[model samples]
Target: MSHRQVMKVLSGLLLGMFVAILSSTVVSTALPRIVADLGGGQSAYTWVVTASLLSMTASTPLWGKLADLAGKKVLVQSAIVIFVLASAGAGLAQSTGVLIAFRAVQGIGVGGLVALAQVILASIVPPRERGRYSGYFGATFAVATVGGPLLGGVITDTPGLGWRWCFYVGVPFAVIALAVLQRTLRLPAARRPDVRVDWLGALLVAASVCLLLVWVTLAGDSYAWASWQTAAMVGGSVLLGLLFVRVEARAADPVMPLWLFRNRTIALSALASLFVGVAMFGSTVFLSQYFQLARGESPTTAGVMTIPMIAGLFASSTVSGLVITRTGRWKAWLVAGGTLVTAGLGLLGTMRYDTAYWQLAVYMGLLGTGIGMMMQNLVLATQNQVSAEQLGAASSSVTFFRSLGGAVGVSALGAALSGRVSHYVEEGMAAAGIPQSGAAGGGAIPDLGSLPGPVRQVIESSYGHGIADVHLYAAPLALVALLLVLAVREVPLGRRAVGE
Candidate 1:
């Protein structure tokens, strides 16, 4: 390809990626209002996010496989088209179910966008130069991470253009990405002879993941942890998981190669990605809610408060990527990132309704820096370890686990918050000489504006306490992640494309 053509393809890839990330991140700040407007409860809110994560996680390998079979350009454009349709459908949905179903569709598109972007980038950039461009990907990740909440908050708070616009807003950008890619992006095709998709493997993997997600989502809420529902979900998940392992081993082209797990580097990276996903996605998804409910910030203001986190992420990720490229050291950053994430979560666990804003900012910054250092480097380290042909499988596999971890964490944490909030609300109301009956409503906590000032303060305080507990509860998981990072052997950085 000509230099101009290469640049055009790269630009289109980045733009498509930005829109994909933007759609996911931007919904964070707007979720509370969106759920309320759609007449749903906390579980609905959790599902809204989980459904997307589930679809995204499950579809990633499929997209990668498709890219290997079909042409990259065709798959990427098709993903964008599907994403546009889903976004419009989600924006126009009248009910939570419709919104969730469409969001799932959108997630599938996001899966394609994410996986194929890496694939195409690898086709153009060499391993050494890839880091410099990986910096761009990191920046794009940070921007979308920051912009999603900020934009979501603004759209949610704005009159006559509420949370729905957050979904609608991406439609035009995705359309543009599709048109640009169609016109400008060209690449060598992966026309492997006798290529066939492993559809059964895909179905088994999806079923297994869905069962597991549902189990996590339902545990400690719809049933006791030891109840029949739990047993069924947990049992069914285990069975399907084993079945998937068997299927992958036997399939000519498995969605996930069972052999990939044998590589220590790939295994470690996947584990690290899982923890990072839990810490990064699980924590950030709830920040907007905490800021609005606990700190009493407006949605827009909540988005603004997150600047320290985004800034920390961008700075650390860029700096670390550069230093790793120069020095060929990566494992230390993984260990450090995990440690920082642990510390950040612990700091956040100390938060209260009246906690100083500066303190929160500091905690957020620490968390962001840790995540920045760890997330992409995990992929980088894995890429360095695997062969070129294994690139698609390895990359998609890491992404798949990371996303699955996020979905699991969100469901578990969301359920915890729901229960904790109920307990605190009850305690606060009783302490204030109000009837316990006042806290009996089974949906989302009512809007603070609707309550009397004193009652509202109590509600806010309860939410703050509950959110702090959520962080505290999740801290051990981050610490465990930190320990896992420590176990990863330091691997020298190589001149290998991530999707090698």
Candidate 2:
């Protein structure tokens, strides 16, 4: 394909990608308001985010397998339709239950989009020249990641417009992406007739993940972690996972092929992504709450505060991509990124509600820079190690694990934060000689603007210290990721002819 042709296809691909990324992050700022309006506790707040991630993680491998057998254009269009309908449904939801259901449906489509965009790109662009295009993709992602939160905040804060518009806003973007793909995307080959899907493997994978997430999300809040409920869920999940391994080993077309792990690059990248998932998604998802509940910032102001992180992401991804293209070196960037992530998370762990804004900005910048350098390069590195035949499976496997890590990290960290806040609130109440009955229950998520002055201080301080505690827990995970990155052997850049 010529440069102009690549741009035409990229225009649609980028827009579709923006929708996926935007849908996930936009809700972060609006979540507190959503939970308050819908009347849920802290666990519900985490489940809203975790539900989407769970569905996305569970479906990614199936979507990747489908992409290989199904026509890419048709699959892409189907995903867009699914996403648009789900988004509309989510916007219309009157209850947390309904919203979570819609978000899960929306995640099915997101899984497809996330896996397909890169798989298709790998098909069209040779790995050597892919750096330039990948940079464009990375920049588009950075913009969406930053823009979604602000946009969601603005929409939610706008009187009479409300938080529902955050869900509705993706409709127009989805429509545009569908039209662009219809007009511009061209496939290289016809769909094969002999392809078969490993339905049992898909089922097993979903069952295991769902069971485990159920335990992870509900154990501490709904029941004791050491009870029969935990035994049932954890044991059931392990058995299902084992069955999935057995099924995949024998299936003609495994949704998640077990053999892919035999490749060193794939194994390393997937492991690194798993740890990065815990570090990146676990810590950052709470920033909106930090600004609002801790610092007492409005929704829009909280959105704006995230710009420092975005700036670092944009600068590092753009600069590192261009440099890698010129020098044909990427491993050094990965190592530096892992190191930065560990350092950044470690620094962020010490912050509390009263921590200065400038210090927060610096810490976020370092973390963002680390993510920018690492995320895409890992995928790029994995792609370089395989033949084109394995691209879909290989790429999607990495993504699936990363999403898994995110789902687990979010659920676990949210629970941890909630527990810490409850403890702190109890301590504060004791020191101030306030009756225990007057203190808000630990699970309560209240509107900051409506609280009495003294009560608000207690809530904010609890949140501040609690969120920081989660960061402290996550820093070592980032260090684990850094260690994994050091183990990844550098593979040579692809010298395959461009536009093959």
Candidate 3:
């Protein structure tokens, strides 16, 4: 394909990517309001986010395997249709349970987009030239990450629109992407005469991930972390995971090929992606709450305040991609990005509700820059190592682990946040000689406007301290990602396609 042709197809692909990302991020700013409206507490808030991640994580590898067997274009279009339908359902949901169910279905489509986008790109673009195109992906991600919250915040704050519009806003963009993709995408068909999907492996993988995520989300709040329930859930998850590995090893067409892990670059990149997910998704998901709950900012104002982080992500991703394309070297950027992520998380750990906005901006910028440099490049590095035949499996495998990390991280961090906040609020109330039955009691998220000044201050401080602790816990994971990246061998990117 000519450069013009590639760009033409990429327009549709990036738009699809944009829609997928937008759907997830658009709800971040409005989640507080949505949960409160539905009469849910912290666990419900965490589950709302985790439901999608859990489903996306579980389905990613299956989508990738299917892409390798089926044609990419049809699969991409199918995913868009599923996403749009689910988004509509999510918008009309009257309860958190209904919304979560729709979000889970929406994740099945996201799994396709997230895996197939890179797989399709790898099919057309040579690794040496892929960096330039990846910059476009980074830009789309930045825009969606920036715009989703801002748009959601506006929609939520708007009197008539409410939080439901956050789900609806992405539908039109998706419809346009579907039309453009049909017109522009021209890929060689991928059909195997004896294609056999390992359905058992897929099921086992999904069951295992679901069990683990449920355990993590419910462990501290619903039951003691060391109780028999924990043992049962963890044991069940491990058994299912082992069964999945066994099933994959013997399956005709494994959803995730275990042999791929033998490749050094793919293994290290996958591992790095795992830790990156923990730090990136775990910490960033809560920033909206931090602004609204801790700092007492309105939703729209909170969204606007996140611009520095997005700006830094945009700059680093664009610049690093250009440099990598020119030089055909990517290891330095990975190392630098890892360093910055660790530093950023560490710095952010010191922040409280009363911390200066400038300090918060600086810290956020560093974290975003690091993520931008690392995220797509990890896939780029992994894709560079595999042949076209294995592109889907290898690409989605890394994404699966990353998403798995994110699900676990969010669940664990959220649980910790809930417990810490409750503890802090209790101490503050006691110190102030306030009753335990105040608005902040019962572990429910409080309405700041409804509380007295002293009580509100206590709630704010609790959230600030608890959130900071989450960042502190995540910093070590970023450091682990840095080590993994450093260990990755730098291979010179070739101009020719894989297996050429």
Candidate 4:
């Protein structure tokens, strides 16, 4: 295929990417309203993010391995259909639990889309020009990041329609993407007479993650972190994880090939992705809460306030992709990105409920720019190091680890935030001479507007500080990625692009 033909195929892939990314961010600003309407607290808010990431993380490797054994086109189209149906189901959810269940289902499709889009591209494009194409992917991501929040905010704030519309809105784009892909994508058949999937490995990994998440989400709030529940969950997770390693090492077709980690680049990239996930997902999930609960902004205003971050993401990804493609000197950008991300998160740590809007914007801009530079580039770097046959596994490996990091980050940070807010609210009640026993109905997540002046102030101040503190925890982890990037060896990219 010529360059024009390649671009034609990419059109459908880009649309699929757009719909997938759109589903995630659209819920960010709408989350508080969803929780309020569905009747839950911070745990529900955290689960909304965690459930998706958890499912995505667990399924990513399966999708990648399957793509290698089965065929890319059929797998990609199936993912699109699953996403569309899950979106419709999510739109009809009447309770937080049901919504969460649907979101988990949605995540399986999202995991497939995220991994396969990259796998398909890697199969078609040469390493040298991947940065350029990846830049387009990054641009698509930024567009979805920008639009999802803005559109979701608008829908949530509308007169009659609510946050449910955010889920419904992406269906048409996904359907069109499915239609376009069926016509344009041409790939050789991928089947092996002796092919086998490592189902035991997948089930063990999912079980371990589920048990661990249950522990992270419930530890402080529902029971003591040092109790028998912790012993059971933690011990079980460790056993299951080790069991998974054993299974992968012996399986004829492992979900995660153990040899891939023998490559220094893959090993370090996976490590960086893990830290990035913990820091990135854990810290950023609460920004809407900061704006709405702490600053008393509406969903629409909160969405608008986040524009600086998305703008930085767009600028950095677009520019870096072009630069890497032109010069083939990609290591500096990775180092620069890690530094900016660490610096950004560190700066954001100083913010509180009363921090000025301009200061917050600057900090968020730095974080987003750093992420844009680092995110796709790491996968590109890894893809450059692997054989053509290992492309899907290699691509999906990076994605799976990143999602893993996100799941842990959201759960651990959610625990930390919940604990911190409860303490602050308790102290505030005591200081204001309010009765401790019945304070705000035992610390239910209050509708800030519905509370009395003194009570509202206390809740706002608590959330403001709690949200800020989690960033401080995450900043050090991002710095760890910076150190890893500094040590990564840069490889020259191929000048000519290829296709299947």
Candidate 5:
């Protein structure tokens, strides 16, 4: 395909990618409000996010493997359909349970969209020039990441439009993307008739991840961390995980091929991606809560406050990608990204509710820049090392680990945040001469507008300090990611496709 032709196909893919990201981000600012309205508490809040990540993580490898065995075009469209239906269901949900179920289903579609987009792009474009196009992905990500929150905030804040609009709003964009893809996007089919999907392997992996996440999310609040329940869940998860590995080792067509990890680049990149996911998604997902619950900002204002981070992400990804394309060098960007992310998280750890917006912005900007430089490049590095035949598995394997990290990180950190907030609120209440009974002390997300002044301050301070602690806990993980990236041997970008 010519540059123009590639661009045409890319437009549709980018739009699809936009909707997937938008689905997640758009709900971030609205979540506190959503959970409160739904009569949910902290555990519910964590599950709302964790449910999606868990499903996405579990399903990602399946989608990627299926893309290799089946045709890409139909699968992409099917994913779009699934996502749309799930979004509609989610919008109509009256309770947290129903909403969580719908969100998990939505993640199955997201897994496909996210994984297949990379596979299709790599299939169509050679690695040497892919950096330039991947930059477009970064731009689309920036736009959607920035736009979703702002859009969701406005919709949530607007009279007569409610939070449900956030879910509904993506439908039209998805429709347009589907039509555009039908018109412009074309990819050669790589269908195999004899290959069987390792359904049992996929199920085992999903079960393992689900059990571990549930355990982490519930341990401290629902039961003691060292209790029999903890032992049961942890032991169950480990057993399932072991079964998954054994099944994959013997399966004729594994959901995630075991041999891909033997490649030093893919292995190291996967490790880096896992830690990055933990550091990035785990911490940043709470920023909306920080702004709204801690700082007393309206959803709209909260969205606006996040612009600096997204802006930095946009700039770094675009510039780094362009530079990589021009010079065929990417290691420096990865290393620099690792450093910035670690620094950003550390700086963010120092924030209180009263921290200056400028300081927050600077910290956020650094983190965002680091994320931009590393995210796509990690996948790029893995993709560069694998053959065309193994492209889907290789790409998805890295993505799988990243999403796994995200799922674990969100669940674990959310639990930690809940505990920290409870502790802080209790301390604040005691210090203020208020009875513990006066506080909404069961890890419930309180409505700041309804609280008495002193109580609201305590709650705000609790969230502020709690969220900062989340970032602090995540920084060491980012540092680990940096170390992993340092160990990834840089391979020259090849002009020809792998196995060409």
Candidate 6:
């Protein structure tokens, strides 16, 4: 492809990725409203999100592998098409079950968009030049992250443009991305003949992930931590996980190459990504609820409130990426990112129902700065260490772990919040001498709009307190990541030759 064509294709990929990411993040603020209207409880709400995550996790490596064997352009275009269709289906869904199913389809497309975009970029751009462009990709992701909730909130809060619009919003963008990819993306096919995909490994991994996520979602909510249900689910997950690992070891082309675990950089990057995913997805996913329900902010205002974090992300990623490009040093940034993330969580942990919005914004900025410095750089650093032959496997491995972490984090945190909120609400009701029958049906938190002002405030406070407590859970995860990052040896940055 010509340079002009490459830029066009790059633009399309970035836009497509933006839409995919935005769909997920933007829906967060709108979810509580969506769930209440659809008549579901907290478990249903978590499933709506978890279903998408589970599908995305299962399909991500498959997409990466396909990019290597078939063609990046074809996979990316197909993904955009799927995304549009699913987005429409989700928008039209009348029941929570249908919405979750459609969202799962969207997640599959998301997996494709995310994995192939990176693979295509690697195909076209040399690694040295890659850093310069990575800043752009990171910025795109950051903007989507910031814009999603804000846009979701505005759309939800606007009469006649309710939560359903959150799903509908991405369709036009997907169409544009499709047109751009068709017109601009061109590439030589992989030199080798196609090989068989490891369907068995894929199946095993999916089953294992599903089982584990189910365990996380149910543990401590539907059952006690040590109950029979918990034991059965945990044991089943471990067994299936071990079987998946064994299958990967012997497969001709495993979805996850077991050998990549041998690379120290890849290993550490994967581990750090686990923490980053938990901290990033686990925390950010809940913030819209915190702001809108807990802090009495309108959806639009809540979206606007998140800008500090986005700004921090944009500033830190662009600046750090450029500096690394110039100085050929990345480890310091990694250390800094981990430190900032840990500190951000520590600050957020101190939040209460009465905490100031500006204070929350400051903590958020620190969090975004930490994430911007870490997320993409970890993948870039891993790519730097591996040979080109292993690039797809290596890169996908990092993403796979990240997705796994996200799945685990979202499920675990959702379960934790459900438990905490239920406990707190019960305590508040008892203290207020309110009868359980007077509250809304189901022990789940009430809709902010339906409750009496005092009841709403109590519920909101419970959520704020619950959200703040989760950060303590997140903080240590980040600190552990920081220590792991310290052991990663720095590599000099430069333009990578093809197949280096």
TM-score on alpha carbons, each prediction: 0.95, 0.97, 0.99, 0.97, 0.99, 0.96
CA lDDT, every prediction?
Answer: 0.82, 0.85, 0.91, 0.86, 0.91, 0.82
Candidate 1 residue lDDT tens string, 1-500: 44365666788788888898898888888887788788888888888988888999999988877776778898998888888889889989899999999999999998888788766666666555555556667888999889989998889888999888898888888878878888888776777778688898889889988988888777777788888988888899889889988988998988888898888878878887887788887788777778887767888888889989999898888888788767778888888998999899999999988999999999999999998888877777776666666667777888888888888888888888888888888888878887765553324745766777767777788878887887887778888878777877776766644444
Tens-place lDDT digits, model 3, residues 308-401: 8899899899988889999999999999999999999999999998999999999999999999999889999999988889999999999998
Model 6, 1-500: lDDT tens digits are 45475677698889899989998888888887888788888778778888887888889888877766776788888998898899989999999999999998998998888778777777777666666667778899889988998899889988888998899899888888888778877777774575777888888888889988988888876778898888898889889899989988998888888888888888999998888888888887777767876787777777888888889998888888788777778899999999999999999988878898889989999999999999888888877876666677677777877787787888888888887777777788889877766664324546677788767767887888888888878899999889989999777766754444
Task: Please report how far candidate 6 places residue 235 from its true position, in Å.
Answer: 1.4
Q: In terms of TM-score, how similar is model 1 to the real structure?
A: 0.95
Residue-wise C-alpha lDDT for candidate 5, range 1-500, written one tens digit per residue: 67898899888888999998998889989999999999899888888888888899999999999988998889988888899999999999999999999999999999999899999999988898888888889989999999989999999999999999899989999999899999988777798998998899999999999999999999998899999999999999999999999999999889999988888989999999999999778866899999999999999999999998899899999998888888777889999999999999999999999999999999999999999999999999999988888899889988999999999999999999999999999999989988777586538878888889998999899999999999999999999999999998898788775636
lDDT of 3: 0.91
Model 6: weakest 10-residue lDDT segment is 436-445
**On a 0 to 1 TM-score scale, where does candidate 3 land against the true structure?**
0.99
TM-score-superior candidate, 3 or 4: 3
Candidate 2 weakest ten by summed lDDT = 491-500
What global local distance difference test value does model 4 have?
Answer: 0.86
lDDT of 4 by residue, 380-497 (tens): 8888877766777888999998899899889888888888888888888889877665454222556878887888888788888888888888899999999998877777877644
Q: Which segments of model 6 are wrong by more than 4 Å?
A: 1-6, 440-443
Which candidate, 3 or 6, would have the higher TM-score against the true structure? 3
Worst 10 residues of 4 by lDDT: 436-445
Candidate 3 RMSD computed on C-alpha atoms after optimal superposition onto the true structure? 1.0
What does the lDDT come to for candidate 6? Answer: 0.82
Clashing residue pairs, candidate 2? none
Q: Tell me the lDDT of candidate 2.
A: 0.85
lDDT of 5: 0.91
The list of candidate 5 runs beyond 4 A from truth reads: none
